[model samples]
Target chain A: MNDQRPRILLADDEKAITSNLAPFLERGGFSVTVAADGQAALDGIAALHPDLVILDVLMPRLDGREVLRRLRRAGNWIPVILLTQVGEAAERALALEEGADDYLNKPFDPSELVARIRSVLRRVTPGQPPLASAWQLACPPEAPGQPALALDRRSRRVSLDGRTLDLTPKAVALLEYMLTHPGELLSRERLLDAVWGWDYPAGTRTVDTRMAELRRALGDDPARPRFIETLPGEGYRFVARVVAA
Target chain B: MKITWRDLLLAALPAALAGVAATVLRLSLGRLAVLLLRADIGTALVLLGSSLSLFLLVYLGARRAGIARSRAAIERHDRESGEARRRFIHRLDHELKNPLTALRAALANLQLALSESDRAQRVGDVRLQAERIGRLVADLRKLSELEERPIEQLPVDLPGLLEEVVEAARSNPAYAGRELRLVVSQVPWKLPPAVGDRDLLALAFYNLVENALKFTKAHDPVEVRASEDGRALIVEVADRGPGIPAEDQPRIFEELYRGANARGFEGSGLGLSLVRMIVARHAGSVSVRSRPGQGTVFTVRLPFDARDRAPVPAAG
Candidate 1:
């Protein structure tokens, strides 16, 4: 039998970060190409024609944003995931607007990146409906007088009642997943597996942190939530109406 | 000795009154005077003596009023400076006590027989605490020097200096996952040079960026943007986080004033104060605009050419 694995180009100036992250990506079953700077990253992406790119926001020469800008200007639609430092929400949004597929803040658990990579790949692959279309199908249409949460996949933004909510990518992802499967009981393990991926450390509070942040952004009280409801020993449920616009 | 018309009038009024009284006495006791001494010499002598006494009284009264006014002024000055000194000492104690307490606790934790990971983490905490203490001391020293020492101003590249500050912030491990962006709105090639101490200006920019990052989340980007504002260059560090409360905004630049929302954050509360001090030392001014739950923008306006401006006077 024949095996074809997805290719990923990892561009970062820090050797310590790339060296560690490259091996992790390879172990997760992707052909990884390393670029030490922005120029090299652009060269590597063109030369390798990788399926996806993980670019660091702060890089020498061209920088991650510039690289992404150039790639999009060249009309390359390959999915790109930005590796950003913390406190860069605006940069993340800008990158997404510049055609980046996703972004993960630095000091991130490598497993989360892997999950994002697979998820983005699945959306871009030939056979499957894109993630956005799938999300739309799962979401209800906007109705008057009812509180609605809408996630714009293209911009990577979440809005409630026409107001853009300030939510971290993780929180946004969690809310998106819950919105897609409204009223379904999602256990902690299942949510973790779906959101953080399988390699994430067990007993880590990744889900809880994301959930708490999501709840806070929604203004949903834990005890009496209008959107997310905690089921005691079970995971959580999105009780509010989710609309796709 | 150079008496004015008013002084002359004051001096003459007493003598004139004494003269009038003496004349009256002379007229009334003319018979008695004629009978006793056969002259008005006694009345003239009494009048002269009374004039001297009244003049002396007026002079003494004026001197006493002047002394009282000077004493009140001195007391006010003393009270104001004393209050300021007390506030400064209180802030210093609070800032120092924080790091000292954290360092002590970290050290005590290190002494425990813990696992390798726990030990390493404890050691990291101790190092961080120590660094915090070092930073506090360094900031205090810099602030004092800024107040006392005259800075060595030189032609410094404003954009390059901002880039350096952003680079330093990027390399900070504590903000490893934090995003810092330097947006130079001016023409890169034609950017004007600012006259300042490179190190001090860089420190001011760094402190502003650091302060923004401290209040914001890892996902929020702390934007450091610089543009030319007429003859002055304006650098703004903006953050989209929980903004400063209206009441806190006024005192945010005050030394050791932590905002109401700053609880649980690891800060010495000297960052903004130091930023203001550094900027002022460069003959610049720093101001902040923030709305609660919206965000904050700290703007530092520096003259493009501060070479001709006088050095900021030392704070008393």
Candidate 2:
């Protein structure tokens, strides 16, 4: 692997997956190191110290989950991305809790995996702290007079007027993306691509339905303006004034 | 066998002798002793013994005559009740099927008589009603079948089954504008044959997937997915529609039941019943988890195979 280019350690038991991903990541301008199994990936990690590691959940000789547990236990805060075979939320949360930086489900689009890798790499560079740790992923901070919206990154929860909002998984993803890019008028297409994986259709009513659900969850009147403002022809924008915490 | 004077005299001799002895003893004893052994007590005791003997003799003769007749009557009654139950179910099944079959025939005839302009509308209505009948017949058959037979199964590829169901649903205009997605791991390995009756399993999955697509709004994607969890294969049909009401979850799988929100929706209320029957026949179980408006997930778990009784090792 080249020293200057960001190195990603890819570990999956299946050769086809790693092989398929190699060209895709190389095209995206990243140095890729492939490991056939979990133990090999961990050994490579200790030696090579790659910028990111994408681990598969099912593998012989130290499974992905155990690998993650050990790495985190060793205080190696190397950003890790878990590859899940099933898109089960509980399993994904378990991986995240075990110190995985992010995860992508199998049969995932190459572009989406690369995007997540970039997102994690951008957050946890050596010189800088993780942006997700510094800022709330779901909502802005709402102290005494700070802001109307407060987001709790660790919990993936949002709050308004001191009341917590219960949002679904997809709703949280969309909200997190919106919070990361505050004040930009994000088009529906762009928002769909960024939040929902690239595999989802571009023009889908799912976004509209979810936004309606989000508005309902946020206690905002759909007919009137509140935290989220609809741009009519444009997409939704988070317009609440941020009060400094 | 003929009674003679000599035999009568012999029978009376013992009683006469005992009477004489009692008289002598009464005379010889003192008044206090005679009073203590009262004369009426002996006579009452003799009468009580004779009556008990007579009662036993009469009872045994009557029991011998009545037992066989009573046993036959009870057995006949039991057989009659069982026959009645069978006849009732048979009649109900036949009665329920007759009108639907008649309507289907009528529709077919109408289709022949009608020209191209009205043919499409008539044919579509016919198909919808025919499906309703098919669902009803399936329910009745399942209700009866599950009571008697277990699944006789061959290996079924679930993905292939799902593809056929989705294709069938798509062709129906009622499912227009909805996106149906079949999401499975690309592992490409087939599930160990879940020994299950193919026709019954197909009906169950078709009902679940079709129902999911129907409840969802236009253009909303309904996802059907399968995955291995331990030794069980879990197949789920999930809909992002207004989910079943919480109060209805426990009872939705019941026969001829529809949730309060489902009252106005177009359904026969037999879809879930048929699904449950089929699952039960395959030695499997089904459950639903949902909150109103969040969407619902119906999960079915079937054993992997006979030899693999132990739970499949959890994903390493």
Candidate 3:
């Protein structure tokens, strides 16, 4: 294992940003590799197993969100910094819940990007136990027949109360995040940074758009929400009490 | 459908003329001869003349009536158009109010937060609010320009125009709060020297850059770059952030169409609309390519021929 320099994988479709950022990170004393899209980033990460991964939220042939999911599923504990554009607060929260270390919004200063990369790297470096001890705790699977979450990994299908629910990829990701947090209040900005990744070029209304869709799929009303509740000037929280079967 | 005063006058004209003419004719002919002729051809001639005179009078009355109705129709159309204009003005005023209100609030917050260490933080709030107002103003300007004098054909120095635009955008009161980076690529530049009015074209590019920077988060660097692609000059402003939704791509440049993702982002939703209008005015075009989770790339293509050169005054 090369301990001389921390290796970071930076992936984005834009050549200018990627090229400009690579040198900036190198100046910050981090070894960086540029990937054009999500799949390429994933392939690069698999080959390199870098100390940190900086991924753009939007990409072709599989988005950043899906790539992050695969990374978690593979049990790769590599610290990641997701870049999102505006309006991705809710999505950012989902990424955090899925175990991403940090995130940033696009048009971000190269210096700040380096700073955040350092922050995440410091938290989860090799031979150093991560600072947040809660993440280290192994969670037991849910008990049987107690509000069971029947998720079919192959079909991307979900059901609650014997009724099938059709939710968008982003909404499903949010639900999964909320389920993991279970009663924790998630701010809109934080959520956006989590799911969408930094530089997910949008405004705050992306959360509202995906939330509205989620509510429609879950048979929840915005005026009188059952599962997801608003925090009033802060963000949203998933309030449902569940015990997996 | 209601009857007018002209209709009444038309109805009365024929009868009035016929009564006066008949009385005069009766006075000319003596009663004895008239009584003898009344039994023969004289009576037939008088009856025929009276009927023919009445027919002519009725025809004149009907023509006058038709003219009157048409005049009323024109008046009605004018009134409808006036109302429509008033409604449009009302809508414009309503749109203008939101940004102004936000700007006021942001300024107030800045004044309050001045003593604190987070004054720098509050600066962003103030700047964002101001951007909201700037966007609204840009939208209004665009509406007025497109409606009034439209630019048709003019040569443009793409690089010079871009530089001026970036400078204007960065200097804007709303945008002065953030760090702005303008990158220009050096190539054998081909530009028609005597392009359009530097002011109007500069304003168009300024609006586009302002939008890119406005939509970006604070503390982040907003990028402005220009490069020539084949026969077209391509200017792009790309941010590394959450991009616009696929559904909104088509409508982003439409007047008054705010995307679902733009809530809490200070904008009157007219920046892109204005950009399109200005580009179209110069015989150029603008387009957006975006993905939901990725950033957006806004492209402005201005066609130019190096041979067409005219020395126009630079913008003051």
Q: Give the docking tier of candidate 2.
A: incorrect
Cα lDDT tens digits for candidate 1, A75-125: 777787877531223433353346565556554668878877886775464
Report the number of clashing residue pairs per model.
Answer: 13, 3, 52
Off by over 4 Å in 2: A1-3, A85-93, A125-138, A141-148, A151-157, A166-207, A216-245, B1-316
Model 2, residue A208: C-alpha shift (Å): 3.1
What DockQ do the predictions score, one after another? 0.01, 0.01, 0.01
TM-score of each: 0.40, 0.39, 0.32
| lDDT of each residue in B1-316, candidate 2, tens digit only | 2355754554455445555555544444444355446765665555555555555555554454456445655676788677756755664565456547767776877758657766776666776666556546545544664556434455666676667666667767887667888887546455555666544566688788888877778866788888776668889999888898889898788666667877657655667876887787788899999878779899998877675343457576
Taking the tens digit of each residue's C-alpha lDDT, what string does model 1 give over B88-158? 78878987787789888988988993799989998899877776776566456546645765565567778
Q: Rank the candidates by lDDT, best first.
A: 1, 2, 3
Worst 10 residues of 3 chain B by lDDT: B190-199
TM-score between model 3 and native: 0.32
Where model 1 places Cα greater than 4 Å from the true spot, the runs are A1-245, B1-77, B102-128, B171-181, B185-191, B306-316
Of 2 and 3, the candidate ahead on lDDT is 2
User: What's the residue-level lDDT of B115 in candidate 1?
Assistant: 90
